[model samples]
Target chain A: MSDAKLLRDELRKKYLEFGLEAMSDEEVVRLVLSLSCNEFDSFTEKLIEGFGSLKSIEDADPQALVRYSDIGERSAVLFRMVSEISRCLAVKNVKKGVYLRTTADAKSFFAPLFTDHREERLAVVCLSSRLKAVAPASVIAEGAAASVRASCRRITALALDLKADGVIIAHSHPSGKAVPSSGDCASTELLASALSRFGIALIDHIIVAADDCVSLRETDIPLSFRDRECFGYKITKLL
Target chain B: MGKGSIHSGHRDRMRSRFLTLGSGGFSEHEILELLLFYSIPRANTNETAHALIERFGSLENVLAAAPEELMTIKGIKSESAFVIRLMHDLCKRYSATSDVSADLSDDEKLEGFLTEYFSENHGNVCLLLDMTPRGELRSTKCLPTSSLLSGELGSREIAELVVRNGFVRVVIGQCIDGDKCIPDASCYSLTRLFAETLAPLGTELHDHIICCSGKCFSMRKNGSFSFGSGGNHE
Candidate 1:
């Protein structure tokens, strides 16, 4: 076999045995590029030099990737596909029937739904009396880049429809701060009161911004419920 | 009080408790007794439930018991056995539906899922995870395996399945009966054979996980095998 073929074979062997973590950024890029390009060694080197790192290469748009002399549409598409797959795999959904009792649980469950959203969005997690998620988190509202409104009437109606004993409200802020706005705090109190009149508890309100999330109940916000003693059976903490 | 009135009063209270407090309010025997109310009818199942727990050691084992094994106990007829089996199948169905959209690309998440997937079964089985190009799980298939080298699941058959399903990426999991998570030489050979067979078809074998007795060993993570173009072993 030729020298290029020998090197490619060696890399494939290493990947199959030791997996992706064992490979360097250049080696991984080379292996992926080799699948599409004939003279992949030079193509891999050129792309790496332009992008600077494996993460940057994965994040690079197809248009930017195709600017390289050796990288064609097929290679560009492959690179983008790999990047998209990695992202999808990374942000897993909170499965149904999982308990959402703590702020940490609420964060993990809500964070994935808000990933990569430029526009603000609001979601409600309907919980059973036992604090287990009764259904998948529902995206109730979507608005412009900076602000989204939560409809108290609509949220109350949804809780009743699902027969949920409690609900956790979450919304995304594209501005990259997990702090709740004054409007956020005001609306959460109103939402809590509306839910409480019907015997439903507004367990918590979470604000997600970029990678960070903050639970409003954990904050100094003075949001109070009419019947905090109702769903006091299974909820141990963060009630 | 007579037996009939006493049984009726107890049943009414149990039903009321379940409705008000859910499964968390009930003990193991109480849960089983509540379940048996539908199948057995009228008679107090509290004793039967206790007998089942004593025989099988736990509610999980009692539910997992074979129909014949369940019928070995007094008052557990075919109807009771059928209900018990149905409950077990229902739990499996619920778990499967809940986990339908699970992303199995992360090693730790994948291991946890595989371990739970194989928890009930003591037999050797091979699980195939058909994933989309975007790494989302499309479907999962579990096939019983006597051995890896057995003709039950050859590399050609796996390749055909991948091609038929149009799966761009896949994960193969082998669940052994015992607690040894280590994969022998046959496992390595099978991985290479699978990788080679699928590579030509543009389908990538993402990883081969070995799950044994609640523990999981990831071949891709540990790494020592090769799927070279030629027969050049490293």
Candidate 2:
């Protein structure tokens, strides 16, 4: 067998024999570098531990990952590639009408495709009549402030064009602090106000930062009440 | 010249005279006159402040305009303008750097960055930056929020960006309130609606922020309850 295959086989044996749970950090590092695919057990576990969990690792910054002793630029890049692939797959599945049940479930859907990125991103989650996510589209860079007008116009236009029933807005903070910014609060109100006039529903806004993601609805801000809508306006009850 | 004269009034008068003289490239003495505006309340800063304003324009404009704009005036030749410009650019770029990535999936970072940017603006001007999946910066556009009653954010505006530029992700940011406050239900609802519409196109809804004067709030922080759709992302 080739050296890579042989090395992978050897590591797999070690992983099974010692049980991956008991491996040392050094051993995990050595094994990660030797594996054919960087998605080895030790590498993933190391990434998870460093980031606190798979969801966090997926949301971590690439440069932060590179800072790890065993994770060089190459490994960091590879891991990011693997993570991005997973994010794409998750969005793809959701777009295919997959029902998302929990935040963990959402993380799993995106873990393969998005991880360790330096730039910010914005996406629109399109839903059908049943509230199932049917598709997601990137709304492009919203700048340092995640303002509503620009994002809302883009998503609203897209929703109108697609004749979608509803939409969700989600994005990540590379700073790894998922606490909502004031801008986040304002845009949420603006977008919701704008879409209310169109008969389309705005369901939620999600923030994905390092190791933690927060949903606006979970906060004390009254969300479900029509009388409490933003811009001093109420949206058409389309949910 | 009487014994009951203001002890330090002479300094104030001299400073104002210097300010007037400094209007044509104010000397050090003339510039010091304007610095007295805040320090010496009754002090006459007419000559100095006028000179400074002549050299730099109105104080409001001087502070509001870009440092590059400030440097265009005479007698302000120190690296201060460059420093000021650098500081402003750094702030913009720092926020921009927060979302720096070549991969398209990392676009959420960009969205987060912009949300904070726009949430701080009180005006109507909106800033939009487009990118490809390869992390290349694309075209930047400005749109008025009030005028966008009919304009929708469709893929056509970003078609070349996504296809030719290889941008798998995109983010949009702007500021409006100049005071970050909790978003209303409509905000959360609109974001969710957008996510649902864009799902088929393979794009993800990252975030929406309301930027106020000095603060920002992420809808996701409070919008999670409304999202309800839970699944593995990675």
Candidate 3:
């Protein structure tokens, strides 16, 4: 039998016998595409190698789907479309509200923004006194541009401009991990102090890496981390 | 003491705190310091974390930064920078699963699921979501307004698509510009017609949704040609 035929037969058996939940990423993709074993092995290996993992493949640009995997434009477009639709479906299922409820709320709201985004992005959501979003979350920063290194001066200025009573700041990590960096700690403090100067509360500083969002406040991070930093720029900015 | 052994105690202490309180247990700087212990080994992550926060301005910025940019930090080696990137990445990469838990299958959630497609574009969008009788989603097929207008697509056109896609149950949708999602007579008549047409092909019309922006109204929810008796409507 042809390599394609063997793959199709196995997939048919899998679907009939086990279930989709038991299938690996490569198996699912192979079953969907109906590629031969050789094609499947090569495509899966190359795609996984180029992108970080099976889950991470969806994060790659559509062009990468074609260039790296040797899939035709039509298939690449289909892959992109399917992945995008999946993300949309996930976002749609969440409860809709403007209020900053919990870290889970922030996570769902920000997940769509990081979908396959290649460069880092900074999003600032201004909130009313009730913690409801006053306006659509705005992308105040991106890539290597000036905004990426958001100055405390400008960030605070934006809060005042928006007339926001509270603000939640978020950013994407294209690199897949959502762990906060030292810079993330320093900037959140800087921005928090700057926002506080005008009595605008900083509700949270969220880190969106790949698909996960973590609010610094929700994590109950150790307080000692804050003690040492207070002696430096935060005090100067507060003054 | 060896380098790894030196930080081991602090690592265990910090890990214990993280295990107990999650982010509640540590400040943002402590969070970064804890993360750094993995990559830098013997180095003083406390000082490194502080230095990084000082250089990058905040923990959020540091995580969002590219690895190459992170490497520019004085004590951060390539290995540590990559690890930092991973720490930030692990959250989003895992959450991207979009599991659509069992509880989110209500009318509002169902419509909300369809509305996500509309939020990305403004046009007469059409979608066919195939799902099992248990309300588990199978696949979603979309026809953009650029390809075929939702209002313009006839029963035969859409019914043929249903048959071609090999689905027994299908929920259809179209996007409009305005917010008021009151399903018009045309929506009812088209769904009624589609139900009659799809009935012959052994396919069931689950729902027809009219969506605008992030809001959507379901024809099925509003009882537009209820399809209780298989594909054939008496």
* Number of the predicted model whose TM-score against the real structure is largest: 1
List, for all models, the DockQ compared with the true complex. Answer: 0.01, 0.01, 0.01
Question: TM per model?
Answer: 0.37, 0.30, 0.32
Q: Candidate 2 at residue A21, lDDT? A: 48
Against the reference, the lDDT scores of all candidates come to: 0.66, 0.46, 0.58
1 or 3, greater by TM-score: 1
lDDT of 1 at B65: 98
**Which runs in model 1 stand beyond 4 Å of their true positions?**
A1-61, A69-82, A85-92, A143-150, A210-212, A226-239, B1-234
- Pitting candidate 1 against candidate 3, the one with the higher lDDT is 1
TM-score of only chain B in every candidate structure: 0.54, 0.37, 0.48
Q: Write the per-residue lDDT of candidate 1 for residues A23-115, one digit (tens) a residue.
A: 776887787676556788998877665554454454343433554334765555444443333333233234578988677788768766665
Candidate ordering by TM-score (highest first): 1, 3, 2
Which regions of candidate 3 deviate over 4 angstroms? A1-97, A146-151, A223-239, B1-234
Let me know the TM-score candidate 1 reaches against the reference structure: 0.37
What 10-residue stretch in candidate 3 chain B is worst by lDDT?
A: B96-105
What's the CA error at residue B58 for candidate 1, in Å?
Answer: 40
Query: Per-residue lDDT tens digits of candidate 3, residues A53-157?
Result: 344344333433554467644334324433443443343333234666565666556655544344677877777777677766766666764232465666677
Cα lDDT for residue A96, candidate 3 = 33
